[model samples]
Target: MFTYEISPVFILMEEVVLRKMHSIIGWPEEDGDGIFCPGNNTMSNLYSVLLARFHLFPAVKTHGMSVIPRLALFTSEHSHYSIKKSAAVLGIGSENVIVIRRDERGKMISSELNSSIVAGLVPFYVSATAGTTVCGTFDPLNEIVDICEHHGLWIQNDAQWAALLLRTNQEVIHYHNRLQRAMCCSQGLLQECNQLCAEYLFQPDKHYDVSYDTGDKRIQCGRHIDVFKLAFEAQINHCLENAEYLYYKLKRTDFKLVFKGKVNKVNFFCCVFSNPATQREDVDFLIDEIACLACEL
Candidate 1:
């Protein structure tokens, strides 16, 4: 059982960090909206779907699922299972979530996505994968975007791995801008969808700016201040560099690689380099350990 007491200071810090994140993701500073979630990417995925649902069918918020048609959302087979989990939790039914086929590299095939959009189910959202879970493959965004735009669907880029790339690589900045509605985690639309406006906590007649009271934006009453941790970890380039070093080393070794290329090329192996403290020597040691273990097998 986890709980936290939300404070005004925490809310201010969250807004600052979220705005910085938006800027880094290539959104104009004040254009996008976001909120910090107490859970992981799964929770974030759920929140994104919730926002999309509310965006498309605002009536569902008050009238319940009965008001809406048999709604459907789209995601790749290689995409996170959280999408399906989100569907279930939102009463959309897991079976209703149409799975689009992926290519050999584990990316959502745009043609298949286009073909999948039929008449019966009301397709309102598409959860495009920025970096997939197992293969680390990024779905073709340019193609996906064209289809999403034509179909008039809300696009949510599940860029859980994007922060690392945005910090280390500049080339992706252009590609990121094409994302229409939301990216990564929660969005500003969240406030509209989930705000309860509980009088005691979020009184509008307060002395301070009441909008700073971000806690009411979440379904949870007590939210852990996770934004502080994100703000503190400002150095991530070295971590990516170390991972790249390891990637090359593993390529030269006898170990059978799952995916032979980097993220942009085709696919990437999940070699975590998240810890800022990881060094070249540590990568070397890991490679050596893998080689030794291979010899045993």
Candidate 2:
């Protein structure tokens, strides 16, 4: 049987980075209490850490109160398997997960959610998937946020594949309109780099300054490089744009746009062609040809 290992140093580093980021982002609301450390990266570890934190504070141990051991973790059936998995990991019983039913088109059934919340199962947290994998449908975020607030539940927005909300103009207009259009993408990337530096820049209670002494809170020390190298030719590669153009061209024939956005990705429906008149191999060859030609340019 495989067992979880405890690494004091590694856990300390991870917690420090998480806390520092929380401070920088002003999230999870730092209350001056010491943070709990769980020495693993699996979904189980996440659940365990959260439960362990609740243990330290008995105020959250009641039914209607803050220390409720009972957690009604909410997510749609279309959401990732991790939701139910995390519940099981925390020993809350998978039945406690409370999977919200979806509509005919697969968006979460809001009425069912409303009924359930009114019944008072006492929800603790919700994980909303910004992009459902099988069909890629985004749930109504504003509506969901309102529901969560009414029930006093925390929300974790999952955006692994659908975090491109940074590209919209109406949203960015609140900060700066024409100027943001000029440098938003570049500025966003640079900001990510700067935030990382702030976390790992050899300061106490941060990453780079932890010593490797006996019983010290670190597994490894000395210089180690973690760098991501992108190809110099990445800019010249217009494969994504070419593919998108081809997608739009095909859509002009008979496809119906279902969900339209550049963030979570655009979804469309195309009727099945009766005759297999279009050569699949030829289409592949044409796309390859277009990519090669664009690269050469």
Candidate 3:
């Protein structure tokens, strides 16, 4: 029988570079925490801040959102519904969670966001996507951060698609793993990653001095530690590095802009459209032509 290792929710440790990375990213370096959730995926991470915010009043745990005034939250219309789910579960109600508009490429329209913020509602939090679901798009983090900072709003970036970097060469050069060989994420994603780390700094280990333990910086409470931590990081890096090549290759094709933007450093782009001038009738003819060509073979 294949034994299942039932590890705890999280391995209680923080990356040694967690704090230093935070400082460089421009986070406060004082008020942040990372956790590793055993079964926790994106929603758990989203729900965490809801719990923390309620804890701010300390009575909300017992009283719920009823104790506070009508608070509001914000997320992109194209974002994963987890934002709304978090709001509903937190007792904030889905209606109060404002869904911001996105531009043609699925990126959040920052100007529309700014307009919404001043629409007389007490907006407290704004959750942005690092890579959106449908188009694999990215929100404008720099613009979002500026708005959030100016409005005293808490900003959460859902980077489940691009959670952290994986310096493969330096970290996992000696390790061997199937998945680890995938992404060594390259340059394009650096901007998004840096902004997230800086704006949402995660530095909550008392030791805080310097240790390579990065387990604590995630949102999952009971985290499971990867024995080959550096190796795992390297693997992700490797994966992204390879993925960038595909982006380049695909961009070389004359595909239509299904999701227009620079090659995403995180998720793969799904280019599903052809040139605007291409006719549907031509597509049908091409399909038949391909069928005939296959038969000829």
**What CA root-mean-square deviation does each model show from the true structure?**
4.1, 12.9, 12.2
Mind giving the per-residue lDDT tens digits that candidate 2 earns over 24-122? 333443331122222212332243324332433334434323345455777788877766776675556679878888765567776677677745455
Which model scores highest in lDDT?
Answer: 1
How high is the lDDT of residue 131 in model 1?
A: 75
**Winner of 1 and 3 under TM-score:** 1
lDDT of 3 by residue, 183-282 (tens): 1112222122212232232343434431223322333323345323333554465455544543564466553334565434345435333133444455
lDDT of 2 at 199: 33
lDDT of 1 by residue, 97-135 (tens): 999988777899999999998899999888887778776
In candidate 2 the C-alpha lDDT for residue 202 amounts to 35
TM-score of candidate 3 on Cα atoms, chains taken together: 0.58
Ranking by TM-score: 1, 3, 2
Which residue pairs collide, candidate 2? Answer: 9-217, 9-218, 59-67, 60-66, 60-67, 60-68, 61-67, 62-67
Question: 145, model 1: CA deviation in Å?
Answer: 1.4
